[model samples]
Structures are given as structure tokens and as C-alpha cells.
Target: MGANATTLHPNVASGGAYDHMKLNNGIKYSFTYELRPGSGSSWGFELPENQIAPTIEETFASLWKFAEEIYADDNATGRK
Candidate 1:
């Protein structure tokens, strides 16, 4: 995917489900994604219909990469 990626550390505490799962369930591999239209677009959640397919494709690519890395790490560490 050709999307720009950055790490966001918000000042405010978001008591979202990801936080709950990580804090309570000991799930270390957790994430929260904020999907928006590509760089110069004025759209937020109101993504244009034409942009939907590309967004989904990019999201799937990123997810696949993440999964691949995790699987590789598990195999290297002999984790099931």
C-alpha cells in the first residue's frame, strides 16, 4: 500500500475496546486504526464512493503485513 503511516499518541485517554482488551486480557498485539481519505482530500468519514475500494484494498494490505510479521515472529520464537 502507498498510504502514509504514522504513530499517533493522543493526550486524552480513550477507553476504547482495544484498551480494555489489552489492559484486562493480556493481549499484547492490539491496534486501533483511523481510516481517512487520502492526503489532500477534504473528506473525513464521508469518503467518496470511488475511494472506498482503494481504501479497503490498502487496509487489507496493511493488515496482511501485520499478520505476516506476527506469524514470522511466532515461528522464530517457537510459539504456537
Candidate 2:
């Protein structure tokens, strides 16, 4: 990812797991989500590099799933 694309959060400004795809509108996009340090429900996604960014609805859906999985894993491991 480029500097601009990777500059999502001041702290989470770099590497993470990426999910990429081309939307029906022909716009290619990817988002990277990484957990913040310590014990809390905090995460962030990188900015899409395409001309058209994903909509708020799309972003929310993706983030909700990502957070749900993390929460599940944490609960499974008794890491809360």
C-alpha cells in the first residue's frame, strides 16, 4: 500500500490483514484491519486506493464482521 493508502490511523498506520475486491462499480478496493495494542475493542482499516472509496454501509458491514470474529476469539480464549 502507498503512503496515503496506509495512513488510516496515526497509530495503526501500517500492516494488517487485508481484504481486497472489485466492486460492481468496477472500483478495486482493499481494507486492512489490525487490533490496537492492549485490552480493548479497537481496530482500524486502511484507506481504499481506488478513485471511489467504499460506502459507509459497506465499511460498517466489513468492520462489524471483523470485530465480531475478534470478539469471538477473545471470548473463546478467555482473554477478555
Candidate 3:
């Protein structure tokens, strides 16, 4: 993936797994989560009050899954 696209779906940024996407309405928002058991044990997906968790949940989950499918078993970190 290109640098811009990869940055848009960050699994670690600014000390967290932060990500951002643009909505159809032209509004932009960001979310962050955790996957390892280092500082915490929660996969936090911060969203607007009116938003749902499933969207971010699936996004992060699918990102990893997609990486697994495209990379070798020993180097499947979903990272380009």
C-alpha cells in the first residue's frame, strides 16, 4: 500500500493504535485501539457519541486478517 493509505489505517500512532477515515459527508474522524498486552489489555476504539463500535471493530479486525492473507505465515503483521 502507498504511504498515505497505510497511514490512514494505523495500528500504532502517537502512542496508540490510531486510525482515521473520511465520511461521505466530508467529515473526518479518528479512532485508536490497543492489541498487545504491554501497557493495557483493552482494544479501545474511540468514536463519536452517535457512532457505533462495530464499524471500527471490523475495520481493525479485517485489516489484520487481510494482512495475514497477503503475507507469509511468519511475517503476517498486516504491515506494509
Candidate 4:
């Protein structure tokens, strides 16, 4: 994927779904991903058709890695 990444804290007062799930519903893990056009493209949310496959592939890879790491940690800690 090799994409630049950053973490954002949503405004609690905004009461977005992620905030509600994490703050009110006792869900410890939640994320919001904004998959925008690559690098210098000004397309914003409108990803071009040509980039769709690559974007999906990159996102899938990232998710897979995240799951693998979480599973490994759970195993190491003996958490079911």
C-alpha cells in the first residue's frame, strides 16, 4: 500500500457513529478510514475508475494485516 497514514480524533460533540460506538456502546475498537484519491490527485472522494482496483487491493491488504496482528496478540495473551 505504502500510503501515508494518520490518526484522527473525531469531535465528541459531533456524535458520529464511531464516537457513539466507542464512547457509549463499550466497543473498544473502532476506526474510520477515508480512502481518497492517491497522492497528488485532487479528486477527493471521487476516486477515478482506473484507481478503484488498486485502492481496494490496498485497503484489503491493510485490513488483513490489522486482523493478523490482533489475532496474534490475542493468542499471545491467551484471550479467547
Q: Give the top-scoring candidate (lDDT).
A: 1
TM per candidate? 0.69, 0.36, 0.27, 0.64
lDDT of 2: 0.49
Q: The CA-based lDDT of model 4 is what?
A: 0.67
Query: Residue 15: error of model 3 in Å?
Result: 34
Candidate closer to the true structure by TM-score (higher is better), 2 or 3: 2
Tens digits of per-residue lDDT for model 4 on 1-80? 21112234233234367656776787746666667564577897887899899889989998898889889987998977
Candidate 2 lDDT score at position 11? 68
Pairs that clash in candidate 2? none
Alpha-carbon error at 2 in model 4, in Å?
20
Give the 10-residue window scoring lowest on summed lDDT in candidate 2.
19-28
Candidate 1 to native Cα RMSD, angstroms: 5.3
Residues 14-62 of candidate 3: C-alpha lDDT, one tens digit per residue: 3232222332333233333333323543544444444456556766787
Clash count of each predicted structure: 0, 0, 0, 0
TM-score of 4: 0.64
What C-alpha lDDT values do all the predictions have? 0.71, 0.49, 0.45, 0.67
* Winner on lDDT (2 vs 4): 4
RMSD of 3: 14.0
Q: After superposition, how far is residue 74 of candidate 4 from its true place, in Å?
A: 1.7
List where candidate 1 sits over 4 angstroms from the true fold. 1-13, 38-42
